[model samples]
Target: MSNTIDREKRLHNRTSFLSNIARQLGRTQPLTQVERPALRHTCQNEVMATFSQDQLKDELVRYTETSLGAKAVVTTKADLEATLKQLCLDYCKDQQGNAAAGETIVSATAALLEMVSPQSLETDEHKVHVWDAAAGFDANIKIAERAKVGIVLAEEALAESGTMVLYSQANQGRAVSLLPEASIFVVAKSNLKPRLTQATALLHQKASQGERIPSCVNFISGPSSTADIELIKVVGVHGPVFATYVVIDDM
Candidate 1:
């Protein structure tokens, strides 16, 4: 009874004192951090449900219809190996100054060597790879020697629509996303999810556990493209003319 009364009075007194100080200071934030329990309360945000496969497909389709071109799904290791070879022979052959897509992956660089030009683009031992999804990709790929295209890994790519998600990190530099004209991505079957909302939620969950989200969170649909010039649809004016997404099954 009395205790409750005292607590109420104390809170009231505190509020009054702070309010007075605030008035005197004329916006007291620049000098000292003021008390605002109300502001802190707003920090708690509502977590939304992530997208399902169907939703992801829709997003992909929207992107493809506008820019991103054809996509392929690879289920086995053999498929990956074959695709790597195909990209080297096909994408690099005729392209002299063309910038293709960057290949994206979590790890494993067995076929990466083949994708990079066989020319002496490497100084010391670093091979000149046009685009590398693996972290710390410093080697310059000799596109001039073969073909110029970039490949990046999709954190999550929607199957129905063909959209790719690129979560930038220190290892995965911003250059991989920007410098290349074309982009190639490898989305493993294991990581494929349904929606963008869900994927953002997953990223949020990681951030909550004291993890830092990459500097860039890109949702690329297809090639470097722009319809901004005089409202005419121009491809490769802004980015690659062709961006391919290869869906692979985990082994």
Candidate 2:
């Protein structure tokens, strides 16, 4: 009888606690959420200073070849998709990782494609990797044995130092960049700006609204680099040795 009574009391309290949830949330109905609107500003400075075909290729090359020492190529949507497919085929040829390389590439790249756009990349491949890219942590572990290049969709940038700020969340994983030999940034032009000062203020504005910042706030200017010994260059010590920024211009 004592145990029975105690169980009933615990059940009652659980129900009562659940009943108070709506009041705590100030909701008589389901909570509706809204996205923050995008802010737009023009490039007041010289476009050439920031935008140049030569610099674009050079920057990617510097990070890919020297820093990360990656032999990555920049191409159109079609080219990237095809390249990924070819990579999978190569991996599949010898049953690498017991997976078709095409599937591994497709599995990881698919999630990225969906985040960037649905109609953008061809998705009907219907192939899935043994791992999922959205599972950033798990994916990093699985890809641990091989060279990996992570691409983060940055929310903002500071032109003063050519620094890019990537917010870590469900889509942006800590290991996605940290575990890879080379990490790339797909900077949405919509997030680009001319100054870090302005970006810091925006951060404060969000904080004022009681929004907690992400777990990891990264501001990267270049690859994982160090100059400790005789000021000589050593890269990819802690993280990716090479870094690339593929700036997607906003209209």
Candidate 3:
């Protein structure tokens, strides 16, 4: 086995290094868990504080369509399944006019499954794969890679930026969104927030209550794009090329 010294031992002057920093900062010793300052100037919370939930959703729809170049649709809980199926079919349409040419993979969240069971979405013409944790990583990822559209339930939707907040868990993995050609994010109106400020507040509250925070949090807005190559804008260079957000107003 190769030998590589531990970082702690390699930089053994840890205490003295901190003490010097503390002295430079006019403190006798390094402050231990000092309370954060309460006063701060920020307009994040006040940006859309006056908008109603419907207004916020409208703003998200407009912003996503115009600025982010993504499709956004508002639907009711009763018609969610039909909306989802039609959207998946459109995305999976083949050159020969077949609607069921590609697979659709969905997250295994209980909320999503309750709304539209994957079994109901499946037909003789098409297949729908759920993020099955019991099948292990290899099996689930293989399906995701081949799937044309990935559907996931967002924990929260940010109105200002048209962003969908996703928290990774054992049942919901990031691969469902990253691997597919297109992604469909389903979010409820009640869970929609004004912006990132509210989303961060919820996470902070969870931390204060000593609840387990998610290890991976993703904020996705529209499709993957980058202008790094020759300063020319390009889409789908990093991940899925198409993105759509389906908002359930009644729920």
Candidate 3 lDDT by residue in tens digits, 1-251: 01223334555777888889999888895558557687587787798999988999999999999988899989998999889988888888887767656798999999998999787776666689899999999999999999999999999999999999999988888999999999999999989899999999999877656566799899999899988889887989889999999999998
Q: What is the lDDT of every predicted structure here?
A: 0.52, 0.52, 0.89
lDDT (tens digit, per residue) of candidate 1 on 70-189:
545454555665565455334444347453433322222334334333243322322234334442344533331233445555678644345677776544555554555445676665
**Candidate number with the higher TM-score (2 or 3):** 3
Worst 10 residues of 3 by lDDT: 1-10
TM-score of each: 0.56, 0.52, 0.85
Superposing every Cα of model 1 onto the true structure, what RMSD results? 11.3
lDDT of 2 by residue, 69-179 (tens): 344344454354454443333333442444222222212343356544322322344233333445656554656425344455567755445566877665455565566
How do the candidates rank by lDDT, highest first? 3, 2, 1
What global local distance difference test value does model 3 have?
A: 0.89
**Candidate 2 whole-model C-alpha lDDT, 0 to 1:** 0.52
Q: Find the candidate with the highest TM-score and give its number.
A: 3
Report residue 222 deviation for candidate 3 (angstroms): 0.9
